[model samples]
Target chain A: MENPVQPLEGTTSKKVFWSALASGFLTLGLLLVSFGVSGVAYAVPIAGVGDFYVEFDKLVGKGYTFYPKMGKTSSSDSAPQGTNIIETLTIDNLQLYKDFQVGGEWIRVKITASKPVQISGLQHDAGLIEANAKFENLVLEENNSSDWQKQFQQTSSTIVLENAKLKTHYLFQKTINMNGMKLTVERIKK
Target chain B: MWWKRKFMLICCSLALLVSSAGLFSQGIKAEERDTEGFIIEADRVVGSGMTASLVTRETSKNDGKPMLRFQYNSATIYGMKLTKQVHSDKGPVSITLKAKGPVTVYGMTVDASAISFKGACVKATETVPALGMENVVMVAHYMKSDDSVIDQLTLNTVFGSVGPKKPGQLKVLQDLAGLPLEQLKKEIARISAGHLPLTCEDGTASEDLSGPIGLIPNPLDEVIGGVTNPLDPILQPLDPVVGGLDPVLDPLKPVLDPVLDPLKPVLDPIKPVLDPVVGLLEPVTKPLGPVLKPLEPVLKPLEPVLEQLEPVVSETTEAVEKTVQTVCQQVQASGGVITKELGLVLIDEALAKKVPLNQVCPTNSSVTSIVVKLQESLLNTLGLGNLLGKLIPSDPMEQLRKMREEIAKKPDGTVIYKP
Candidate 1:
């Protein structure tokens, strides 16, 4: 007799492993479907749902090339003084949504942007990431400025999603008052 | 012991899985649920056209004071409503943020025309853009309350580009132009009993006729009629001639000099003895040296007596004249003996004047007394008392006899009948 609980333990262990594997597969499946749908043209994600920002100086006519390194200050005089080193922001992923499913068949589209990017003026006091765009009607998730510079959020505003698909002239008029802020559209995954 | 440890491990793993699943579910649930902190409403655009109005019951905090601030009230673009707890410690504190309302925003971007904070406010910023639909004037009136006190300040805003676009503006101008004409007519009727014409920039009938509504007529016009004043040009007194001269004229000096010189011959060498015959009676004819003169002293006592006698004389004269007139009138009226008697009495009165009173008076009295007696005698001759006594003979027979005697001594010897 080789310990009576051996086979029983093995069977139970096998069941547990299989279940964990199944759960993992299900998560992967959901992610793959979302990725596939995101590949569709002119699609932007509804912003205010997550903590993310994107900034770009050049307007995207078609395709774009993104640099892995942080952007440099356009004006050398405005560069931070002393040992204050510029922090880098990591843009893990990028996607676009035109009419993505919110819940049921009711689909809502948003002009969105991915990749956490800081505004040019806000580079000195890092910790701010902005992305913005305009559409007919936009519903935001949250705008919390609790943690800002000196708790003094020197950052102008952090936009979650920016829709380049919107009318350029109209967007300025109806949406954002971009007095000194620079905006950029990120490249979608091919 | 190993088996027991494995069992514990499995139990912990199961628990962790269940908790993670629960957490995910809660997250999804939160997404679905509406937030109480979030507010939404409608705001009116105020203007001559469509106006956006906002009315709310919300509160906020300002400067450590519990201030009711505007968050996302009626159409957050126009005004703000307080939805969550806002805290401010120091410095000029204002937490004005925009929140979405019920209405769906359409087109490119929707910027507010203006943002105003009312009640207890530190500072309010306003940006009047096209927040609502076009042609709609947006008014964002914010009333914030600080420390339980609320003061309302309204921000009125209008939309539309610069310059006039509609026909209505032209109508306004036309109406303004017509105003003066109507005013002119009203002023004309109001001034001068509808007689004087209007005298504004738009002419008048004649400036001369126009007087203040109720004023004394111009002395110039009344004195020298017509508008072409005679005193205007010709015949006007010289300004230097009349200016500042004294108006008094002395009574001592003659206005003009006497015509003749004092040295001129004054004699008229008359026909000397041509009337020698007239010199004989010159003594008689010469004035008796005021024959009543020596009588003046004697008459001094009689002055009052004379004054007293005057009324008698006047009354007698009036009575005599009245009696004579009455007698004559009666006689003329009757054409009988009464006329003859009145005529004779009048003649006797006239004759008494030719003879001096001194010559006619009895010499027992003084000269003045004699004059008085003659005057009294003249009254008797006039038959005034006799006539009056006869008309009303209610007197005693002795009085009648005296009156008859008075009537009998007349120079004409006229007989008077006593009643």
Candidate 2:
């Protein structure tokens, strides 16, 4: 009876090992197929900056502030204290959504704002964003401060960019959760 | 082993679910929404708190359906504001306020303190009610309704007026719209009797309206009557003149018949002889017909070329005539001897004056004829005519004469005498 029980346990161990190996192969094959077809599962997320200062020549969506207490309090802060301030806003193209429904009635809402827009202090969270971007005369500065949050509280952060353009569909102050996201930067062939 | 199988199944299911979600997300990203019928463009447009003037024009699509009932050419709104508030005791409430300038609808321009709009749904089953207007003043230079034209309109709550641009135009429009209905039915009854008295309202009778409209007297008919009415007096007097000449012609016919009767007897014998001559010529012409038939197609393309050259040929002929007159006057002033050296000098003078060589001494010009005759006389006087005549054959001389005759017959200068 001891010999029979040892043989049974050995058989069960061999079956379990084969099952695990097969499952690993199946999962790897599925991952490969999905990555090959969708081509978006390999993107790296962007880490948040401490001071959160950015400057672009054009931005095409709404702007809002998450930390109202740290906002600018100078005389030039034209907007209400907590609200986001746009320095020089220009809207190039506006499209009305004809079929937008609200409370069982169609309300004409202009939803699409295309290009030639400018704003200051933009905060955004996007699951996926595709853009044709150009960066000119870019300079990166690193703060040596140990306490990064203290820098924002001391002064209003200012970044100046010249002749920069970024075209994407991501909106400010909106969070989207997508299965996968891809960021591809390819040099245009003349 | 049972736990390992369950684990494997769960892993496979998770893999399938993730891949399916990826594919579905890709599809959603790639999908494009359809926006048809309407397009709006503006220099500056705000999503809310928009204040701008609007100019709208009505137009139809190629399929005879209204694409956009109203198209705004310059409707830009800026600085829109919307506010929303909520209380613990009460629910939330929202308010939107808009301020617009002058609005142009169709051909009328309206200035109002407040204007409201109701946008219709895309489906035909739904209808949107119109919002009311306040303190509106509509001014139109010209307003057209149905087929009638209102020249100038100024409408307000207190005063309104409509009239034609000219005094007589309103009467003309009234007559044109009203007369056709009753007159067309009467004319149709007279033209096609026993058929149902043609009603203008019927579908088939509408097609027959063109017949009555064609019969309506136009300016061209009045112009024709104006031209023929004056001729009536002149033509009436000629009728009596013709009647008075008929008696004089009758008396002469009786007297001339006696003499003409003897001539007819004399001329009757020549008719048989001429018939045979005409019969002999027919065979020659019959064969020429087939030869000429093939040339029609070849000459048809040349007709336009010849027509285009006609004016140029006439202008060239006039230039040649002018040049010959000038040259002849100079030659006659030089005593018409036309020595070879003198001829060369005259040609150099004409060239200096920018006269074309062909026009200076055109091939068959009277000046050229006189110059040739003088040259020939000079050669004969110098005793060289016999020697030159011996070198050139007489056939060439005869051909030259024939070419000169052909050029003289067509004096428009279109022909080029090769000889």
Candidate 3:
């Protein structure tokens, strides 16, 4: 006759196999659920302090396109042959779209700066696009140059924006220095 | 062992499928939810020490207020709400936005509270053709902080075409931006008044008699008087000739009286026959008297001119007779033969002696020159000569040449003048 211990051992091995499979399925399910929830969430808060210099090959937005190039100079005498410098740059409602990879996970995120973004001494040769621009309190002086290329350059005392928003297709940044910086990344739904 | 392995594999596959489904379901749910396009909100935004080069197209319109349209090569905006919705025909389209804020473009600040914007995804229509390819169209109907309307402005990116990479065009629109509404309206009215037809304050079409009518009469009277006074010298010499003729005619009348004395009895018989004829013609001629009465005032001003011209006419006749006498005498002196050449020579000689050739042939004098001088004098007196000179160049030939040159410079097939 077969021993009772032998039958008990077989039953235990089967229970262990079934338990291992259930645990594996549960772990996978929880991971997938967490990823799904994160992807669908409207905002993921990120708090940090850093300064960034970003460049994009092409960024298409609602009413404009941007070709960002940092540290480029105008090929004109009036503008010296060096990087174009902006002393202080401030933007409000900045939005960005980009693809991110974290280890084995891939996420398409829309990052937004919900507060006034301040940057100091940003040097770039980016191209800006606009239509129908009007100026106020403008002062014009002769450049005393005969060449058409060295005609004139415009400088403003200040530029102010109210309730503005921006969206970009891709983003790359080199952080410099920042304080109390908050960014929210919302996963884009396909 | 084989069954357990297959069961584990099946369970892992099932878990993967369930997780993917949950992920997709959540994505779909998120997509279906309605949400605001803007992720940030702010009260104000200020940028310091900014410099940018842009390319753009510009257009303008006047509808109650001046409206400017700008089409840029590309533009990036801050502080805006951009909502995009997928459509069957046009894939994804951004909804129009009504945003409020203070924004600066170029150098001008638009302190508007509300601005309407139609994003670049809109399809091209007849009215707004520049609407696709990330072209942004912004229309700002601005009012001052005191609720007074300022201007209507339009800004957009050029559709499809990206212009030169450099800054092509720059414009300034700050002159009339912050002006008071009432003052601006008054200024517009003042400017428009010059272009529109003359009208009274009550909106009735004005007769506008004050322009030319008020200026005509005084100068016209002075011109007539001035013209008449110059004829006095021409008439003065004729007076002595007439006075001498009167004394000469007195001796002829006495000599003729004796011959006419016997004819009075012969005329008495004819006087009876002439009486009925005169009575019959009286009724027909009576109506003509009143017809001439209306011409009295018109001819009245010309009476002095005509009176001055009368003696000149007689003097001219006498001079012609003298010229004929002189020509005859010269012909007799030159072998008594009147040839065309000899007659011309004699006439030339007579004219050379100041025999008033202008009176004989009026064309010899510049009739237009005289008339123009008179008109110019009149206009000068009315303070209109200089103004008219500015409008119509003093030299007509020069003006015509300039006009021809301008017309020649026009492109071929251009309709410079339409009949």
Candidate 4:
């Protein structure tokens, strides 16, 4: 005998199938929009406490198109080969006009200061996307160079790096600075 | 089973449609407007407007404030900035957009004192033309909101448009020009007294001499301001020159006195011979003498009246000078921003004073306004003659009427015009 439960089971099955498909499609659509355009290139999505970044570069319509990144990275200056990359992140874009302030992409630094300083996003601030936009658990790459260690020991603030930009425009990027003790330079080691 | 599957499909479609509609209804309510974005420059066509893309989002915040972002090449407003939000007269974010080409926007409301669209043209629900993908037409939309009086629509352009598209613009102009000559004088006096009340030596307001209905004596001004006599041009400029030579001529008086003193005695003897000749010529001039003879008796009584009026004229002159100072302060306080409506009133007041107002009221319409000029030299003598050029439409009566409507004070003591 066909039981009444049979119709209920079939209806339940259909409901699960449709709902899953709808939510899956919605998530996929959002990912496609935020991450990259077209299937020509794959953009690596990076998330932070209060920021999100997409990094990729490829040929589009016979031209090289660059995707979003935390900021512009440049290799310049006299240090042990790639050591000058840290100093290049000295960003001073939206500060003031009187002091020859220059505009560029985002800057990063690694430090082991006297205090345990932690930079985080303000809870009340709007306009920021969730998850990857928040720069969470940020750390620098480690390097065991003896000379670099001595330099960090002598002066914790000096990181003399150069970059590939000379911009003097205004900026509006807001972020909290960090100063911490016994911190690891996890990303910068590379 | 097939029917149930089809039902799910219909349900999904309906759900999607409802969600889309809900999302579409809310415009950049919470988001900030960035005006610095979107610069329209000449496109690749060498003389095209610009290569720009506009992205708008109607935020759910504050019931919707549309956020507009623009990326462009070859435009004056560069980069990106958080623009001020704009509101519609009907309601907040009530603007609607219709496009013809690749021009796409996500939101409608703008927030700014002036939404400057250098190449873009904007009106209520205008169809944006597809002038190629790169060309952008930017127009700055500005509105000083007044929701209380929706019927009185006015047109304003930050750059190149008339006051408003509302009806009665011409009627208002006519109304301003229609102010009677005496009424215009009263307006000038009222405006001046309101700003700076002419005070007596005891610090009382000069109510009689320069008040709203100030018995402003014009006897001296009629003569001083008008070129009634033909010899004035030749003699007026020489007065200052002769006064400058007084000290030098004073020393020569002693030498010239002796030479002229001998002729006086000879001239005295000639007067006896001239008396009979003067009597003989009396008949020829007797008709004018009889006609004028009765005026002496009438004039004898008016001598005291005329003498009494001299002080009034002098007092009026002092009050007028003080009025000029007060009026100038008011102009400066308003940041020297002259409205075309106020300019018409100034023109009428200047013309009435016979204060050589052609420099300010240069338009022929001012002459065509009213035949009678004001008796007081309020505007022209006040050195406000240059301000008449700022009047709009050239019709004095219409501008005055417009001013009356625009410059009315709110019960809360705020201005209606620039509010």
Candidate 5:
């Protein structure tokens, strides 16, 4: 019996040490979640200025906002703002989720794609329109690895308003990949 | 050692299970709920809303089977949606969508072919989408019911009328053909009832026809509509008027009646022969009188000349005929053969001497004798008395005779002939 078989003193200590190491690794992993963590923020200026003016500025800024002599913008917001600037936007790898404007009028948005795609829905006022629109000649682009990690593929979308009051909620969203894709959005007044 | 190994395997299995659980649960909520489907082939977005349908391109490999897609943003899905909510309705249904710019709607039914549509700007109500640039709008009403669009009225920007001009009205009216008069009246009445007047942004009234008219593309002809013909109005009432509308008189009838004027001679003294009513050829015959008169004076000298030359011509003709007859008789007499080589040599010698004289007749008997001898030699040499007979044997008579003889001598069983 070799001195009545002294209890194996080190078994519990070995088990405790291994358990502690496993817990430490788990904690480190929790602090550094890696896959699928996106730092993309999709936001449009909504409040500070009037709606159509914002659209007009966006059109002027984006270079797609043009006023037809016959078609008129909303009667409100009399500030004359016209620029020949061509609005060029590039989406690195992020998707366009919404079109928000703070004011009283319903505005129009124009979206051009480099490649053809099936648009999922035309949403306004939070799921107001149940139908969808398909567009041709949509511009799409891929993300460049040398760019910032948050850079995404780009895409474009657009819309316009007829009798809608400014500041109305006009939001749009789509699911897409951005390894390399792009789209452009422009506005025109009616 | 065995127990330790078993324990390690158990721990590994639990770790695998725990890690997989965390990985599998880490999907985006939006993507998880997204019901993406077959790619949208084409769509028309009207106003600000999107109307997309599954499209099989003119070059798609889908074999006529339509695949549905969503029309969202600027992209459409190809047929794989997590879930779908189909909205179907009966009766009059109208859907209003907000669209950004000019857009089109494309769709197909379960048992129907795909069709595309554009929004018709309701006169003062809606505006037409422009070209080149993009526009925006909220609330494009898509009326999908058969009777929902009873009548549509649009403003005539070009003509500035309540509606389009005569040709335009004719176009719209032509579509009403085959419908009963009562039906036309009923349709018109219905249109008038539902007619919505249009106004410009400045609030100017365009025309009175604004209210009772629903302007639509002429189903028969694509033209704007309106009319002015009185008789045409009875057939297709583009415009209606009161009873005094009887034409003051047929427009074609002149205001002054020649019948009532006595100053007009009972009959003109003489009607001019130059009247166009007679014929346009009157001037053509005018030159004939002078032309025929000059022909007499000119032909008089020609008659004398012709008479003087007649005897000479007759004598010359007689001489020529006699020479031709002599030559023919001589040729026939020489065994119907003339020595062409001797004739050619003589002609060549005569021509070399610059004599206009040619062999109109054979001058030497030796030439005729030579021709006859040559003919005899040729006939003998070619084995030909009759030329046609010598050239074409009559079915090989000699061979026929020999063959008949051979047939007579054949052994009884020598030939196995098939019929």
Candidate 6:
């Protein structure tokens, strides 16, 4: 048995406060957790805030806590208490198992050999959410309309992954290796 | 040598027992549970009370078929690559997943087609195992659901061939084929209504799908049950009124029928005289149909635009009226005259007067007024006093005396600088 790597100690492992598309994006979700014996330690030098994943090869969590937005529209209120995600996610291939509980439960994912992923750029922003809207083309007076335009402020995070790699193996199947993946994240400022 | 042989035998027995226990307890099999593609699952969690799951709730769009959602925080896919060969393809694919804790993916399957979903959304099937520790298998294959969807759209295309064809329909189909897995599940919900038993006992596949076709993009149907036809609601009360009139008409019909029977023979004889007139008009009215058909294409698109603009135009007219009223009031308050034909205001004549040497026009200082009078007297000796009077609106002395008698409200509240 090989020992799992431990990294990101003392630093805050980013907690998810997520939402997806105003339509379905506000409904979509993306969560990344790595675990092993004690607490799994894996190190990536790329520094950023918020959830931005390149490849999901090795999964070692005792169990996952998924709080999907129950409502139709993706709003800050759609996710109550701890799980409010207003975002849009683009996934390659995702699958889950019915059982494998260590106290709770989690699933092990193995990326296919031919379908190695390289997430060069990522934008995790839900589209505009407007309320009390005037006409789309109406040029509002400059005086009091400032408050309404505040909703258009761009507060979304962009993520770029550089030098990414994935190494996965199966007990009864062939192994898959992914290397030299580069990802870029750009911010759209208002 | 006998002791060493016994030890070897014990070692072999221990190894055999362990292997047998693993097989019986876990049911380890090669071809049973394998997923080829990317996977997310709740594998092993740190604490208790943590639950990993796949959520596939249908949304309102794409007939709720596009809302095939993988709501679990963790899941896995053992698709084709996990089997004898590796094949990785893009979407227009649907699948069902069984989630296991510590997230071991099992019993996942896929079916792919050639048509694109455009941006409509793809259809997918999702499954969850309520009981823990159940083993499942992943499978892969191609599907043929696009045939029905194409048939529906082709029917629409034939009917909508006239004007402003929505190419977006084909685009919607093509993009729906590639909609992300979560969005695809939404479409699947619209198609399958959730649970899809894709395979049958005899190894035949029959999928019952009903994609939303040519239905006017109606969000209001799902958006809180709005009034579909505005006029229908207002006119609904008239229906009861019309129905009640039948009883009144029924009693009158019995009495009136016998009285009108004698007129039938006379009315029938005139029909022969009207026949030639009708035939003569038929040839003239035949050309009107083609002439009127061309107007439909131009007016159809503008109908909705006009409806939307009607309220705006009315509101704009009211706003302009309010603005004119405000301006008229402001002008009146500022001591100006306004009427139906014209608006007029006049400045104080003192402002037009030239300053007398060192004193300014409208000056009140006694010292400056004396200096100005002295300058006037000197200029008057040179016959230039008349020129000064014409240049200025009035003498500074006369204007100062008249300022005290002006009307009402302290004269614009005496516009003072804050300083």
Q: lDDT per residue, candidate 6, B233-288, as tens digits?
A: 77978899999999999999878997799789879979887997888788778788
What is the alpha-carbon lDDT for the whole of candidate 2? Answer: 0.34
The digit string of per-residue lDDT tens for model 2 on B11-126 reads 99999999999999988754422111111111122111111221122211111111112112222232221111111112111111112222112221111111122111111111
Residue B131 displacement in candidate 5 (angstroms) = 24
| Tens-digit per-residue lDDT, B85-104, candidate 1 | 11222111111122232222
DockQ, model 2, C-alpha based: 0.01
Lowest lDDT 10-mer window, candidate 2 chain B? B150-159
For candidate 2, the share of real interface contacts preserved is: 0.00
lDDT against the true structure, each candidate:
0.30, 0.34, 0.36, 0.31, 0.30, 0.29
Clashing pairs in 2: B48-B80, B49-B80, B49-B81
RMSD per candidate (Å) reads 49.8, 38.2, 40.9, 41.2, 31.6, 30.0
lDDT of 5 by residue, B132-161 (tens): 111111111011111111011110111011
Candidate 6, number of clashes: 104
lDDT of 4 by residue, B1-419 (tens): 99999999999999999998777665453332332211122221111122121212222121112222222121121111111112222221211111111221211222211122212222112122221222223222211111111111111111111111121111212332446656644543443344321112222423232321212234586576666665667798998899999998998998899989999999998988898788878776887888889888998999999899989999998987666444444434544343443334444455445443333333444332221232122233223335654444345554444434443332433322221
Chain B TM-score of all predictions, in order?
Answer: 0.15, 0.17, 0.18, 0.17, 0.22, 0.16
Q: What shift in Å separates residue B50 of candidate 1 from its native position after superposition?
A: 20
Q: List where candidate 4 sits over 4 angstroms from the true fold.
A: A1-190, B1-276, B281-296, B330-416
lDDT of 4 by residue, A55-140 (tens): 11110111111111112112211111111111112222211111111253333332233432222221111111111110111111
Using Cα atoms, each model's DockQ against the true complex is: 0.01, 0.01, 0.01, 0.01, 0.01, 0.02
